[model samples]
Target: MRPSSTGAPQRQGVGRRRSLGVWLRGGAPGVWLSGGAVAIAVLMTLGLIGILAVRGLAHFWPAEVVQARYTPPGLEARLVLGQVVEQETIPAERLRSAGIALPPDSGETLTRELFKLGNRDLYGSDFVWLVGDWLQDRQTPADALVLERREWGNFYGYALEVREEGRQVAKGAAAVPELQRRLLRTRDLSERLERLEKQDIGGVNHALERLRLEGRGLELDGRLDATAQADLAARRAELEARYGELEDQLASLRQERRRDSVVLRDVEGRTLELNLARIVRAYQPNAMGLGAKLGFYGSKLWEFLSADPREANTEGGVFPAIFGTVMMTLLMAVIVTPFGVIAAIYLREYARQGPLTRTIRIAVNNLAGVPAIVYGVFGLGFFVYVLGGSLDQLFFRASLPTPTFGTPGLLWASLTLAILAVPVVIVATEEGLARIPRSIREGSLALGATQAETLWKVVLPLASPALMTGLILAVARAAGEVAPLMLVGVVKLAPSLPLDGNYPYLHLDQKIMHLGFHIYDVGFQSPNVEAARPLVYATALLLVLVIAGLNLSAVFLRNRLREKYRLLEE
Candidate 1:
């Protein structure tokens, strides 16, 4: 407790009263330490973010141009197109086909530009290295690095041009003995069970026949033996028990047979051994020729952001992922806004302050803290499997075998994101609602407005800016989230948008693409990952910018609305 200058208790701090000066002196050190730690953390975070931003932007800068003529060392062996032409008169196409692009063929033959975009693979395979002639200077680089196509190997692993079926056969050979033994064991067990089942039935039928024979003998005035009667009783009970056991064994055998008889496809050479040894031996030098040189800088940014999803690495862009991310975020905003607002309104205005509201408030806050991946599981179960499944049956029965709601797609992505965003929206809206003056509601009621009318006409209007502010926060959170989206819809690639020009154009079963996923796929998964590194940074920057842009727009909108409402206080 701190006493005021008037010698009255001005501040309460515990059970005892204390002078403000003494209290301040005692607590200042601890306050400063905690504050310094916070400040340091904030500064470190900003510094790291600044570095990433700068490095990423720098990657988009164009390299200094150099003109160089094709020349080899005095020993002289150069590989191009399929034929090694003389250093002089080597058609640009010959070099271009091997992954080098010839200068603009504004009037050159079609053969020269044939490999530009449509045939990128032609160059990627042969032209693994580049050398600059440095045309401005008389000397070509003393050395040019190159890949020996005849002996091509790289860090990504060696591509052995072998039949996949041959590989599958080789792998299958390794497992043949074990597989054969299991198959034989299963077949023998099935036969044994079937034989025993037949025997059990026969024994039961024979027992009944013996009982009839004994009954006929008794009816014919013949005395039945006591042993026979005893035997019959024991035999009947034993047979009945055996019958039950046999039935169970037969059922078990049937299930085992079904499970064991899965026909695995024979190896047709459709698999490749991932060669790690050759990969370790691949040359990794940082050198570039004219065509490869062009891939960096602003052109790298443009290609990465604008490319379509391709089969391997030779072709494609990230357009689908960018489209999906933006579309799903917008959809989530549309969905979460209304439900969150309504929930906030009920909780803040209509509900009485009691244990239930307190409990609910605690639960909502806890939900917000749950790890996002857990939300992905929940969405997969509830939204995709439960709700989307039902929708597929009702509206997409004709497309069975192929899933509609059953597969990951855009609608499911939107719904999953909306669920994840709800807590954020609810918390934000509640805070906004809390900040409104109670007198505003009272004034509206005083003017003869119904509770709902007053809420809609006065309270919400005054709180509009805050509501928008809350929604902005919700959208920002939902847009950047990747884990939940991964489980719901994001794939490495997609052929078409969820919505298109065809009849009932929205196809939600198709796994959609997304930018966050693209960065992951290219950086870690690409065979040409060494080259894709710069592209990865370029894509990451785009994603950050997109989310930033969204946040900025919402901030601007909130400010405008806040300004408009503030004037009324005058």
Candidate 2:
């Protein structure tokens, strides 16, 4: 070896080449490529979530209201009051082509500002675009108030005076405090009226409906005697009396609500008297300090989560949608788990394994690939029409024309998703069952246990983690599915939640709102695109958080089950 110096250099080069070839053969290059792909995917997901959070959360912050004197070409200068919501640059040539004049020294590009001019009642538009160069001496006024009204979008103006019963109660600085005080009183009155209308009066209405249905049912059964008719009449009379009392209270509240009003002067020197009862909340964004604005932001976020939808679901909170989504997902989980586990157990443990079993497994796998809408159609036909219609005829013949469970509703929706998700559970459970060591099952049977007992006590415990995995996957799927739900239950705005104080409080027969459907409705079906845009982002963000929370909980349960059964599996 010491005698061949020239060949030693060649051997060293050959050794480096061999090492490179071994690396490729060991699959290191493929592993590196796969890792790079996974990293890119993770980064994209994070970026999307970050964008959603920023856009959605910024909507709640109070923006400073500015007064701008804008002049258009060959037109008189006008005072504009609004919040600057967006800004962008455009080519001057594009503006010139659109018949918009540019200054002699204007650069190749021009800037434009989109102002949220939110007096929809007066202007018929909530937003306006102005050439930034034309806006002269923009000023933020301390007295500029933003009134979030219950109707006609938002109002931006200066507070002039507060009046009660056609008399001026306060003016200027004094008016704001008086206005806030009256607004609090009005809000309390509104909440009281809502409770009376939705809960007390609603309960009476429900009782009356049930009484009518009972009478009809008895009539259909040929069992409506004089005594039964008398009982129904008494119940109806009682409910009517309660309803009449609520009506009188509501009338009195309305009269009180009409007593207070506020005068607001726009930048154009026009005064409009707005009823204080119609305002949701009024705030002076330019006057607010950081602490006050933070509090306002928190309050707005809370209201968004807790309040009911208003303005055709473009405004107000989405509590009903959130409740419906969570309730439906949980119901689907409950319905699917047992049936899935039973089917998997039967197929794997009891059935003879052969070519027929192989064919059945292949069919089950194919079912997992079937379109979700197909499942929805099947659910509508089988669950809603066939089974529910039969039940209606047998037990609810009195409510003939008005179908209860026979129509699209929460129960049918849950069942549809359950069927769609069952294949995942069956496949996971079968894999888990197959993985258990044969020795363990034989040992349990040898220790004076029957085969069934051995399978239940020993085999299932070891397979619990896999079962949890399947359930978690099913939950993730069911929570986000929209198309199938559209056919079965989901609606845009459900005034009353399915789980109300009505009889059979878990009203599975009721149509329910869902977060997925809400996103669809707000994003595409909204009449006011600008007003609903930010809300769409906020709702979508909340939905992502909800899904993440559910998945995390399931993952935690799965980890716990794995830990508890680790030694048994070993």
Candidate 3:
């Protein structure tokens, strides 16, 4: 030991050199950084999933439905623009936020609020007029105003067109920036129009009554006088001819107007639509029964899952979007699996590894990094326009402008997503194929089996486990993709399903709706964001479940195949 002191010094020098080299390579720092990054990513993913789960589970939380009336900011009167006066007003947002589920007299869904100053008595002393400020001093009376709490953009469909001098003129009503020269209240238009028609007819009757009682139309001995009779005949004949001519001119116009008319309200009989802002403003606590908690929860569940699309904001369920998502994903998986597996077989079994193979590998890797929205845009361009046009011409030339394959639909969306995910599948399957030993192929060939027989019976069976793993990965990736499908087929709302009883009912060219797009539509695209918050959470939860279920199915298949093929390698 005493003689080894010099040797120990040399060994220590070598150890010091190794330590210095390790530090220079930054191994510790790199590992720490990588681990930290992975930890952060994992935490974020888990946090999001946790939040969704908590919210979804809260679907069973104790919730009470309350109905209440909304009243706007209480302002007696102020200088709307400049001049100040005794003008009465309420806020519109308050009504939207505080909507109560109330049916109109005839069972119409109208977001209505009872107001004190809205007596509408021409001679009433308590009548209040809505006033707005003209900057500082001047004032203009608003035609109408309602207010409640709600996020912006929830209410967009309700539009009012006030005619002035034979043209639509903006009368002070609901104030949405884009709703110029129109009226917008989340109330049913057909009901409103009918009520207005009745009022106008009453006014005409009242004017006639006044003319008869207070003017020259008084009867003499219960019989009309000569001059009165003559005047009545003349007037009747003139009006009848004029009315006849006008009715003829308006026959076609009325039908067109109904078809293209802007939605006025979300009444029960109308289509399923909502203006969340308007709903929130109109919402009120205690609007629905709160005490029967069990019944209420049951109803809410039904509403959440099975309601149909409705107009005037009547309750329709989110079933359509759910169907679209499931159908599209299933179709995409089915379409992609065969094509991807076949491509992998050719690349691994037949094609020689060369520059072309290297180039393909590079392209596949690069494709995985491309932005999803770009895929959507490409799908819209290539599939919807170019390929769809060709399909239409070949299959349904009779339905030119009516659109068969000429519009974005579930089929186009599935195909686009399949194409987008093909590279993932190819990479995974090829890697799986690579794992099969050459000895297995040689053994199969030595036993009087042809190359095809060897590939089918020996090599393929051995590689099945890896091929399935690739499919699982591809499915997992495809299920979560939203951007591309949005451009290809998903819509905010669709009137009918992709499968309907039309000519060639399995029409793949109609624009169908999906849950992911619904989230985007309800959260950001809505006119009122606050009123739609709960709905947004619900939709998000559904989307996560859909994605998870798809991944789980792939996993189940992978596990089964792995177990089945475990003996081959051994």
Compare the candidates by TM-score and give the number of the best one: 2
| Model 2 residue pairs with clashes | none
lDDT, residue 393, candidate 3: 76
Better of 1 and 2 by lDDT: 2
RMSD of each: 23.1, 1.6, 20.2
Can you give the TM-score per candidate against the true fold?
0.56, 0.97, 0.57
> Scored by CA lDDT, what does every candidate get?
0.59, 0.90, 0.59
**Candidate 3, residue 265: how far the Cα is off, in Å:** 20
lDDT of 2 by residue, 228-345 (tens): 9898898888889988998999899988988899999888888999998899999999989999999999999999999999988988899999999999989998999898888899
lDDT string, candidate 1, 1-570, tens digits: 775575444334432545656767799878989999999999996776676677565544432211223343333433222111112324446565777544563233322111001112223442223333311132212111112111232112112232222233222333333333444555476557646654565556556655665554554455557876677778678777877887787787766654421112201212233222111111111334555555544454565567554434323357777888888888888888899899999999999989999999999889878888888888889888888888867765554555668877788888888877788778887887888887777887988999999888777766777778778877777887878888988887674676754334655566787777777878888775544665576567778778878888888988887888786533
Quote the RMSD, in angstroms, for model 3. 20.2
Worst 10 residues of 2 by lDDT: 1-10
Residue-level lDDT for 98 in candidate 3:
68
lDDT of 3 by residue, 441-536 (tens): 888899999999998888877777777777667767776777888788888788567774433456577777788777777777655343345567
A best-first ranking of the candidates according to their TM-score comes to: 2, 3, 1
